[model samples]
Target: MSGVFIVSDNILSPIGLTTSKNFGQLKKSVSGIQKHHDTALSDQPFYAALFDQSGFIKDSDHKYTRFEQLLMASISDALQNSSVDAGDKKTVLIISSTKGNISLLETESYNPTIQKRISLPASAKLVAEYFGFINQPVVVSNACISGIMAILTGMRLIQSGQYENAVIAGADVISKFVLSGFQSFQAISPGPCKPFDVNRDGISLGEGAATIILSANPKNAQGIKVMGGAVSNDANHISAPSRTGAELCQAITKTLDNAHLLATDIDFISAHGTATIYNDEMEATAITLANLQTVPVNSLKGYYGHTLGAAGLIESIVSIHSLKENLVIPTLGFNETGTTNPLNICTDLLSGNFTNCLKTASGFGGCNAAVVFSKQ
Candidate 1:
């Protein structure tokens, strides 16, 4: 916890595929949702913030899958943005994703499962080798919490004195499989997602990548400090998020414990308001359960849709940058409250003297994680 720190974080987002672009859209409150015409996949008609149509990559040669392409580009910029020496063979790479190039399963005419060739952990190797990282650890968290789990792993390495620096990347592309699967559960919404909204409907599928440079020593320049983090599981249902929010409460409490801070010390709560009826309610319940208040809580899903694994770093990057700018965009498309525990979702961008911001995300497999960051 002493030496472990942040070098820099970069996000390749659905808004612009770059931090500047992402920030540009944020200032304007632009929603990334777009209509889908993948008629072959479904006739129900769903809107998602898919990156495949972003037109940021070449379609020729090496035949890289969408997930791989996003991951590669994100890692490249993250290294440059953080000024990390990728040539350092001693550095380690930690990669995380729920579905790693899963689209390749159908393209290659193979069944999609854990035994497939496009293994999530294997993709980490592909990312590490790109920059000559010889020592690396791959975590294939199929659960929704994989992205945060991945970052916590890298933080653990720095805290345990196992690595001086760790480059962490998370990516997952929207595909027919992921889309149709969410559609099957009736979790696909037709418009912009409204996290914690009374009229909230379901989840929105988005794709992108987020990379962060983690250093064992505190940064002397610009960067947010990764004070501490914790992960948990509801154990209530496989897909039905628990209303008790026991796991979510524990995750934040433990993170605060590690940071030696109290609930009042936290300036903002980046709740995992996925806009779904269950996810929003659970997060609100968790915040109240933790006995936390006097903190502004909001979800960025409305701005960027749900970018899956990339959301952790993407949202964290925004949270860190906001510490200086003191701006958190209003939650777009929200018209009413839908849950018992009301969320103080900023409907208009607000500036405050905030120093510590917390980001929390919960995914499938009953998993959840929370991290606290401070101004450096």
Candidate 2:
């Protein structure tokens, strides 16, 4: 069986539109996070990375919401150079998001009609129909791990011999609903978030979309393989992660084992450093438990902010490009090591020949996931 490979990908963020553009911005240590005083989003000023509403892409048909628009744009760009037929029976589409059309709730209450529009499955159907996909679309809304899980779902579907190609698109838009919820928890940082730093306070929210095309045929792949991945749940708390990082560690161990890799074989790590106190500490402990303490690690949250469902895919795309270019992107806002277990955080852009990289994510439901990408 041909391994599941990333044929093409795209990232639509405040920093850039395509994956290459985003990677270029990261190479220069550019950050999209900034302070905003939009009353529509918050009563008080907050820092976040958001798209320019004035210049956002629009469609003549008002039926498609902003969330669906983002998914369509990303999927269109990802399929530009690939021969994957969206309308073909052997192709599948998977959508990952934490909140799909949740913004509609701000204006209207939950009614039968409104609920149908706000439903993730309904939004996914709209996107799939827009792309002319023949199969029923799959939706992954597993909090922050949604993106990685969507990718893993595509891999498994292809491995099951049910599809030859899988187009995975993940997106989330920042809105008043999302902002107020995070604010309620005091998880919104006043300034730019400093991941893995002692003075780090909270996460800087962001909005973006990303798409990764997976193909069973390796002939035209980008010299990278979706090696293997695994997910775990600690079930310790609804919003907080496990204190000991044991569950996250289990996820990393299983992912490495699935990929037939050892901790020593991993060249770098793309950590799910949300800049939150507990998240960083827990992730650091998990990394140490997996014996990846010395591996060069970094997080893109400082650049793109915590993009919720899109975080995993956006960070994974950056890591993929990093592996191809042999350059490690510096952790944008990290200054000093603050985690209890300590991590070899990349503070400067370094060039080295490395083959495999690990990307990890932990989310609201005590969920943790780890995926490995290798240069084929």
Candidate 3:
């Protein structure tokens, strides 16, 4: 299969509006999470990373909700950095999000006429129209792994000659619906999340949008290339992951095989460390099962919290930057080993030559995905 290169990318998050700004915050170990006492979101104090509403763009001619504005801003910034034309027939758009415009259902005025906008397909169509994309936009909503799966889909589409280039973006805003659902599971951390830490309790939810432009042509591209990707399911439970991590191990092995590389070739890992007990433990088991216990691993959740559908894409972009800068970002809230298997968890920023990286994410419904990226 032909390799897909990431030509340009953007991230709109609580810490920053552009990819460089977000990455700069990450380099400085700045945490975007904060405590909130809003009764609209939750009755109790909760920690979350949220975009400032005051900084949002306001336009009367094309009024867009906060969620839609985030997607537009991210994609706009990404397209500005890329040579691909959004209006060209050869280009495609792919959106990844577990929930798009779901917050529209919580309007204070409650306009029933706008209910249809909450549908994922409808939201995607609106964004596509705004961007002038010729092809119908594709939507991927496979839980937290949605972002990586979208990228994988784009790679396959380009490799199969379905499209010459793909613009992929994902965003999910934190709303009362999502917050209450996770709260029912007792999965919300009281404070900032501590991934892979002995004192880790639960996840700190976050909201963000991310975009990446992928193309088969890599002429002047100095960015990382998508070498391989694989997705697998445990089918063990609806909400819980497999106890043995066998399914995730298969995903990692298949991803490496598709990339024509081995576990040792991976310089580091960008893990889906949600700070939840089962999630961190399961990832550790999978890494050990894949004989990657010695490989350095870090999670961005400590800095950005859990960005749901946007997590994989946002972390992938940061990992690409990590490769470009030859630096390994430390796991922000880690203090000690918490899982059964020993993992080379990065506790501080380390500088070294990095060539290849493995990114992994596991979500609800027992779904897991692994993608390999290499510096070209």
Candidate 4:
């Protein structure tokens, strides 16, 4: 199969508007999370990484919501830097998001016209049309692994000769609906989240958008290559993950096998560490089962909070930069060992020549996805 290369990418978040700006903040151990007491989101004060909309100018013509603006901003940056033509007949657009334009329903202006935009597919079609994509847009909303799954889907399509290029973008804006849902489960952390730490509590909800351009043509694509990917479900629980971590481990193992790489070959792991007890434990067990217990691992949830659908893609782009820069960014907010199985959590930025990286994400409904990338 022909390798899918990440030719261009961008991250629009509270920390910065571009990939380099985001990475620059990460290298400094700076977090975008802050105490927020917005009654619209939650009655109680909570820490969250939110977009700084102070300078945002709403478009009166299109009436694009904040969520739509984020998606467009990130994809616009990526498309500007990429060689792929958005209007090409062979190019595709894939959108990954758990909830797209759902917040519009909460406004007093909600009506039949607004109701039509609540559907994920409808939002994707709007984005596709905005970008002038010739092919039908694809939407992936399978829990938190949606971003990684979308990237994997694009890779398969390009490798199968179905599309020559794919512009994948994901975004999720924090809303009262999402905030209250996690609050009901007591999954909201009062402060910054501490992933894989003994005193870790829960996740700090965040909102952001990310875009990655995957192309079969490697010309001008001096970036990381998408080697392989796999998705699996444990069918263990509705909201909880598999206790044994076997399901996630299977996905990781299969991804590595498909990439023709060994466990030891992976220099680092970008884990889906939400800082929640069950999630951290399950991920630790999975890494151990995959014989990657010793590999350096880190989670960006501490810095960016959990950005839901955009987490996987945003983190993957950062990992690609980490490989290119030969640096393993620290796992922010980690202090002590917390998991039953030992993990090499980088508490400080470590400089090294990284080659292969493994990015894994697990979400509700027992879904898990893993993707392997290599430095070109």
- For each candidate, what TM-score against the reference? 0.93, 0.98, 0.97, 0.98
lDDT of each: 0.77, 0.93, 0.91, 0.92
lDDT of 4 by residue, 26-94 (tens): 999889999998998888898999976833334668667777788888999999998889999989999
Q: Single out the weakest 10-residue window by summed lDDT for candidate 4.
A: 54-63
Q: Tens-digit lDDT track for model 2 on 6-55?
A: 89999999999899889989988889999999998998999999987633
Summed backbone clashes in each candidate are: 4, 0, 0, 0
- Scored against the true structure, residue 338 in model 3 reaches a CA lDDT of 94
CA shift of 321, model 4, Å: 0.3
Question: Using TM-score as the measure, what is the rank order of every candidate, best first?
Answer: 2, 4, 3, 1
Q: Which has the greatest lDDT? A: 2
**Of 2 and 3, which scores higher on TM-score?**
2
Candidate 1 weakest lDDT stretch, 10 residues? 50-59
lDDT of candidate 3 over 1-376, digit per residue (tens): 6768989999989999999998899889998999988898999989999876733555566567777778888999999988999999989999999988887777644565576677788878888988899999999999999999999999999999999899999999999999999999999998899999999999999999999999988772766899998999998997998999999999999999999999989999999999999999999999999999999999999888999889999999999999999998999999999999979999999799999999999999999999999987
Candidate 1, residues 1-376: lDDT per residue as tens digits? Answer: 4646677776887677677677768878877777777775566677777654543446467645677778888888778777567656546787777777777766666655535558776667666666677775566464666667777888887778777788888888877788888888988777778788888998777877888888865442365678889988888888888779889999999999987789989888887788999988888888888877447877888777787777787787778777757777677767787888886777778888888988899888788899888876
Candidate 1 — which residues are off by over 4 angstroms?
Answer: 52-60, 111-116, 219-221
Better of 1 and 3 by TM-score: 3
The per-residue C-alpha lDDT of model 4 at residue 345 equals 97
